[model samples]
Target: MTEGRVALITGASSGIGEATALELARRGFTVYGAARRVDRMARLTAHGVHVFEMDVTDDASMTSGVERILHEQGRIDVLVNNAGYGSYGALEDVPLEEARRQFEVNVFGLARLTQLVLPTMRAQGSGRVINVSSIGGKFYEPLGAWYHATKFAVEGLSDSLRLELRPFGIHVVVIEPGTIRTEWGGIAADSAVARSGGTAYARQAKRLAEVYELADRPSVGASPRVVALAIAKAATEARPRIRYAVPFGAKALLALRWLLTDRAFDWAIMRAYGPR
Candidate 1:
């Protein structure tokens, strides 16, 4: 039944995106993996996943990538909007331009790609839009104002889209992942240190960076495959839920925040990310 179904996954060069591409391909969908690093996805080719050089922040790249898929497959049954990065820094020290770029890739880029694919999905009367959000969407942490903001935007956007598309049989699902072992942590740590390293927040910022860097350790986070499996389930389930938060502990963390008072949450964050 899933033989001819087509899926387009962004940020497919590595991590959850890469894992999802392989998992979906294994399940018999014709998967097209898109990312900025075309060469990094070459390994995906062996798994029968088509690779496209797509920069989600660029309109031209996004448009052409969609066109190529539609031209070849005639329809897209699933779209995983997964291209995003963490711009970790204190709100005061992070540049507005950098913040905009984060939103460009994480929020605006996901929204625009959804817009591009909705028409095709509507024509077919069935499709799934999977936005790769994060647990940060529901909670806050130190040195992650901009990144969390983008994810919060994704959560709201996906919620609204799910309702709007229900009538058309198009389901919008948000996949919220907790700590996952990937280069994402290293990139975020580097950004955190770069923007706030020499400022007054240097000590606190560096401490948070160490926390982020811990993600590289296998024991610190879930494997990318864990999230990938959740994504596959969301895309293929007959009655899929609107949101899937990966790694069972992620939901618990969200619940903890929900139950905690503002001051308590602040204290917890400080204890976790503040200077040791």
Candidate 2:
């Protein structure tokens, strides 16, 4: 049934979103890559991927994007909620407005878009919702409070949605990626320093920023293609797992999180990014 299925991927301008769009399109799906950065996706069209501007934080853009897909394709088989960012800063240092923006981009926009697509999916009697979470969803880090909160919310929301959609033949799957080579790390590192440096958390924020930069390096982070492959598998599988933690390390990291006592894990995270 996934053959020739229509797929819409958010945040397709760069990184994993872009990679997923390419992978899905290469697999013969009618792929629509959506992002506010319309120009960046111009090359995707060469591969037969439809490109459009979509600001996930905006309601009109999301609604109209879904409408366009339904109008053009008559059905939306896969929805990839991949548009998100890491807003890193000490909880006390990050402005409430920024925190709210994080949730708006990472959680509420995803929820609303799913709401818009469910009616069509129900009519078709089949669909897939693939949410791009992170290993951060399963663990903690310094200066990542707002970002982690949004990802944690995604984890919980996707889990509950999977149960609710099963009867309707709609499979909801979560993809938790480990550190991936992307602009995200640089952006997050900058945010951490900008928001927390010179404050009481400056020392820890600097260390967190270093970690982000280190992980962003191609040598350290896995390629976004790895996550894209995992997503394609989830989208096409007859019975995808509840979650796909990519590149092996993500699953092992999540397992360790569950295995260790919270306090012990906290110590570990501190030793890695915060003070011992």
Candidate 3:
């Protein structure tokens, strides 16, 4: 069943998306890597992965990408909604426009792609929708308010979809990854610094920026491959779990969040990020 199956992954140019594309290709799936940077995905072609340019915020792009896949492959077995970025800054420091843009890519774009792909998957009577969320969905961090809000939305959306789509044999799975060695930190830190340049929260935001920079290094974080493995498993496993929490600590954090008092958990998170 794995062989000849088609998988379309957004944000596939790098990070977990790129890793997942490679892993699925290795498992004999016809993989399509979609991102804004088409050139970056060119290397994926060497491993039998097709690369497509996609801007999740564009309606035409999302529609055309799904259409092309259906025309070429006739059926799409999996859809990985992985195209997203982090907009990190304190709530007041982040501009409304930037926050909306963040939701456009992280939330609306994901929803659009899912809408575009659902009919085909339903027609086939079987499919999988894997959403690459983050640990921020369950927990919070300083300067990550908007980013965490988007992921929390993803968590809620995926959960609701899972129940609604069960009758159609369409499985919705969420991959919640902890900090991984990726360009994500650099992007988030840059955003934080940019938004904090003349803001009151500049000092605390910069400190959080340092944390992001330090947390994303290879020594402190797990490899993108680790999250990729989880995505692949969610795609191919029989009766896949509704949620796959990766990098080990994710589930523990979720557990602690549920068991600990709200004040205690807030204290712990703040302690980990250092004094505000």
Candidate 4:
């Protein structure tokens, strides 16, 4: 067990983020779990995890949370950029403001938090950044333009960061979670329907929305623990893989994507989510 090492996990109020926070704290890391709904994380506090309110899209909230951690713990050894959500909609139908908000929450917020931690990690010369991406980062789906773009950005950003931070002895790891048991799917589906329901893409959008709803079920998706364990490994391992795709299904999809031609993959996605 690595004691006294501090860890900060964003979006820790629920789902994978909350699970990872508990797992890391159990493994002897001083864990700080942050989220917009602090009340929702009451259970985390009971498990000895430090719970705090933080909105990733809010610069002051993020900055203050990081600074408070540093002030209290003196150091941050792990920064898990796990605060994000899926906003599904047809690009043509989704409002530009909503699209930008998606980026602010899913992409820029993660980047901003990472920027805040880099200096401390560089000073320590030993730190790890774990980004919670998604299998969508590799593959794509209808009505997922904005969501997939953000994840793809995360994938690329993490790759570049690994190289840049190597000299500082900081490791950047991307956690690509497949369908996990979370409220994310419902929210995404609702957004898609709301945005594209009456548009020309309504049928495809509705079909994809059904797919998401089904995929998020307990039997369909892996447990959040699976992702939590993978993240814990990335945070603790001396040399972690640049990417950790949780559960077997995620790996399979990633393999499929790698083996198939771009057009072939597009055909497959259409077969799965296209209007019948």
Candidate 5:
């Protein structure tokens, strides 16, 4: 473990980000947890995690957060870009503004923060960038078009970055997680319900919302800790894998999708969404 090494994590107020911050702290990494909600992260301070307010969508905020961390720690050993949200609804029903906002947060925000951190990492000649993508990156769903698009972009971005940054001695890794029991499902479900109101796809959207809610129930999904462990491994392992597909089901899903024909995979996905 890199004792005293500094790690800056976004979206650290809850879910995988919160769990990852704790996990990294446990491994002796000096953790700076950034999110819009500072009160929610107050508990983390007790565990030695420094909390910072950050809005990834704002360039000044992103730059200042990195500058503050670099000023304090001198060098950032790891950067975890986990600050993103999902917008779930049918493609046609989702307004272009909302879709743009989704990309603003998921894609542009991530890219902005990465830009802020890269100079320091490049100068140091050693660092890790772990992007929390999703199985949705490899698979698609009716209501997740925009969300999946962002993850797919993340997949490509990380791949290209890994090669480009190799000469700088920096490693870019990705974590593709399956469904995990967290606020993610609730947020996604709520978005679906809101977007479904009065739309032609209302019924199907409602069903999708129910599916997310049920999947998020304690009995079905993996705990946030599962992803936390993956993040920790990516941040600390001597030679971290380029990508870590975790909670088991994600790997199986990716494999099954690859093995099946396009029509067959689409049929399977549709069936899983409930009888059409």
Candidate 6:
């Protein structure tokens, strides 16, 4: 039954991270949910999930979080790198500092956490590193240059890490969720409006913002639970797949992107988000 398996999930205060924590707990894992907002994790405690105040962007915070889990549980069987956000705006409009910060959180933070856990996982001779990426990793979108760049990095990083970790019995899995009903969409929309509003790209940026807003509407996108279940499967399955693109349609979109030429794919993306 995989009893006594310990898991550490970042960004577990909400959304996909929160859902995945509960899902793994239900499946008999000793789950520790980590995020900056410990207050948001109160609900998790009721479900037998341990909560840690972890800021993945900070070196000390991440190290301390991992140390706490290791001290309490003795070993971490699974590590979910899910702490990230979308800094949405045209590359020309988004400040270089903000763009760097986005990479710090989305790419460097994930890498830092993975580095901290790999030693322990290697020593134990078995573990799973589940990275929460996005379909944006495979395709591009207007006003999402920084966000997509980070995700694309995640995809490539995961691919290489998977190959390197194979002989050590550590599996690296990437969870590529499509548009999911979460606070993420609203946040991204807000960022786009703030960065590109009243500028040369204002119209298209707002158009893209509308699409992000729609993603957050009830029933408009898949629930976090769906991605959570897929993450749970990736974490527990003996031979987990390399990547999972959730909500079903995401797979089709990825295929379409591959089959179409660059200009054709770009036109389709613009059409989907362009003003009606």
Better of 2 and 3 by lDDT: 2
Q: Report the C-alpha lDDT of model 1 over 125-207, residue by residue, as the tens digit.
A: 99999999999999998889999999999999999889999999999999999999988988999998999999988998889
Q: What is the per-residue lDDT of model 6 for residues 173-224, given as tens digits with 9 covering 90 to 100?
A: 9999998998899899888888887788899778988888778776678899
In model 5, the Cα lDDT at residue 138 comes to 94
lDDT of 1 at 257: 94
Query: Which candidate model has the greater TM-score, 3 or 6?
Result: 6
Model 3, position 71: C-alpha lDDT score: 89
Model 5 lowest lDDT segment of ten: 267-276
In model 5, what are the clashing residue pairs, if there are any? Answer: none
Off by over 4 Å in 2: none
Native-to-model Cα distance after best TM-score fit, residue 133 in candidate 4, in Å: 1.1
lDDT of 2 by residue, 55-119 (tens): 99999999999999999999999999999999888899888999999999999999999999999
TM-score of each: 0.98, 0.98, 0.97, 0.98, 0.97, 0.98
Model 6 is weakest, by summed lDDT over 10 consecutive residues, at: 211-220
- Candidate 3 lDDT over residue span 51-139, tens digit each: 98999999999899999998899999999999999988889888899999999999999999999999999999999999999888988
lDDT by residue for model 5 over 1-276, one digit each (tens)?
Answer: 579799999999999999999999988999999999999997799999999899988999998999999889898989999999888887887899999998988889998898888998999999999999999999998788999999999999999999999999999999999989988888887888788746887877877887888777667789999999999999888999999998888899999999999999998988877525
User: What is the C-alpha local distance difference test score of candidate 4?
Assistant: 0.92
| Residues forming the 10-long window of minimal summed lDDT in candidate 4 | 209-218
In model 5, the Cα lDDT at residue 258 comes to 94
- CA lDDT scores, all candidates in order: 0.93, 0.92, 0.91, 0.92, 0.90, 0.92
* Two-way lDDT contest, 1 vs 6, winner: 1
**CA shift at 27, candidate 6, in angstroms?**
0.8
Candidate 1: worst-modelled 10 consecutive residues by lDDT = 212-221
Model 5 residue 219 CA deviation in Å? 2.4
